[model samples]
Target: MKLKELEQLKNEGVDHISSIERRRFLKLGFLVTGVYLGGKALSLAPLTEAQAAEVVPPKGKYSYSPHYSMVIRERLCINCELCVEACNGTNDVPSYGYRTDILERRRAIVDDKYETIFMPVLCNHCNRPPCVRVCPTTATWKDETTGIVKMNPGRCIGCKTCMTACPYNARYFKEEGRFVDKCNFCYDTLLSKGAKETACVTACPADVRVFGDLADTNSRVYELLHTPETLVWVLRPKTGALPNVYYTNA
Candidate 1:
């Protein structure tokens, strides 16, 4: 139904609603759950177990020719914050904001022993970027050639719509420029200058962050993701953003 027509419909009191109408509403609820909850919550998948490959794009099937991507080695992160410093310095990020940050988690290993895991996170540069979709002024968009979610600072009116749409919480409003800013994978700083790796990747002493073109099979990022027996995953996969950034301990 057209939005205007639906809006014009008289509100049927809940007590007077028909059974078929209730059923339709319930069906839609289930469909939404199945999509955002990966079908497991409602047991929508019955034939076979879901595979890791479901989240990953097929090999050699990258949408962009360069297909810029990153693979975070979860176990190698040490919380040194060098990567964070490099990113802020390279991108000219404000003191109150961060383009990337490290998250800490403690998990039991064996015999009452717990290990601290430091997780470094940044913008995923998703294939279906919600940020681009919600921007009212065409301030942000996903670059077609590099798959980088770029922002036109001058065009941003500080609406923060893209910030709300980002599932990873990657965007922040920049007070200096009076615009929203997020990670662009050092595109303007390094990639545009013929550099292969981002500032964060180069500054990481632990070698935790691997950045490269995923379209190249021989690239480190591709091997880390496609290697046998390695568990590759993304943050907030239920958002269906199809993020380019992957995580693994391989």
Candidate 2:
């Protein structure tokens, strides 16, 4: 309240603030200093992460016809790796690489307790796929009808540009095929043959992987994401990839 105390406080300039820095502030409530440069500037209340990120697209705005997607029931995964096995068998994935993987994390729970969490990871099949954008060869692309990110090995040229651009680290170079490969939701082996689910979905013993057409109102994926009070999230949302893969515990 004193004049001297107010004078000692320094102003934090708005210049050079990165998007990531702004996102951090968006996640919590904070007062922001405002500047007016001949135009109106509004200072609004802080937004929660979900509101700020707009993680889920609005209804009727789906880009693909079928809007193929997968939902991972994160808590249900037990690291059995049956899904991995099935993917390898179905896709003929080499030993040194994987189209899907399971990751483990330990979280602190009630007093002095830790719980192990297993996460199933694969290509997210982003609506704004970085891989597709960076590929000079047009080897990898998102299927317009199904929304699956697919690869044409013949045109790949083994450049690995797509591999670097992928935020999820989902693609890997196949020594035998001499090209980059990633999960395509089993579009080639199963889905293209009129299969309802991907190999991983069928092999998951814990029912962790749920695959369906998100655009269909009657589909389970749409129901899971729209259910009241359920928290649905995607990995690397900060990347602005708009991934189709979602995760939920409910």
Candidate 3:
């Protein structure tokens, strides 16, 4: 039946699901489950023709040398806020602002039993950054060497265009700096000083944050991405940003 017919039935207080409706629902459920499971299995297999086509990078794209990325082992985060404190201190972030923060998600499992997860979020530093595209003054751009999204404070006009364009809500206006500021994976603060990891990564007691070069196959981030029977995902993947930050279970 058409959607209008279904609405009409609902308007007439017809709440019962007929046998035909039940069969249709079951068929759809099976189809969805099969497709999901199939994709999971395919991700673990060696790159075939179809898989290679999907995974391979197109020429002239924003592929970087080090391809700096971070992986959040979400299941291990305990909302301690030590990482946040480390980030604020390292970057001189104000009390009103943050380069990283924690979010809470709660779900009811069964019989009033609930599970809560603390999710830590930061700048994704996308390969195809919407913030970079929207910047009129070219104040923000992705670093060619590290693939980290960087900001030039002097060039910013405080127009807030980049702030609006960012899908992750990662950018914030700094009153003292008189410019938009965001996470650069602590590149200028620590990485340039020869540190191997970001402040947040080093401060996490639970080892929840893994920061490294994604391009290097020997790196932890690369191995985590390649691990079989593991689920890896990026936030707002539908935005087509190709974020460098990834999330997965411990």
lDDT: which candidate is best? 1
Using Cα atoms with residue i matched to residue i, what is each candidate's TM-score against the true structure? 0.78, 0.79, 0.76
Q: How would you encode candidate 1's per-residue C-alpha lDDT over 1-250 as one tens digit per residue?
A: 7756764677667657755676689999999987989755554342122123357788856878799999999999999999999999999999999999999999998999999999899999988788987898889988989999999999999989899999999999999999999999999999999999999999999999999999999998888888999899999998867888899998
Please give the lDDT score at residue 92 for candidate 1: 100
lDDT of 3 by residue, 25-68 (tens): 99999999999999977853422221112222332232677878
Query: How much is 209 displaced in model 1, in angstroms?
Result: 0.4
What residue runs in model 3 are displaced by over 4 Å at the alpha carbon?
Answer: 1-62
Runs off by more than 4 Å, candidate 1: 1-53
lDDT of 1 at 217: 93
* Clashes (candidate 1): 0
Give per-residue CA lDDT, model 2, range 63-83, as digits (tens): 787999999999999999999
What stretches of model 2 exceed 4 Å from their correct place?
Answer: 1-53
Looking at model 1, residue 71 earns an lDDT score of 94
Q: What is candidate 2's local distance difference test score?
A: 0.87
After superposition on all CA atoms, what RMSD does each candidate show versus the true structure? 9.8, 12.5, 14.8
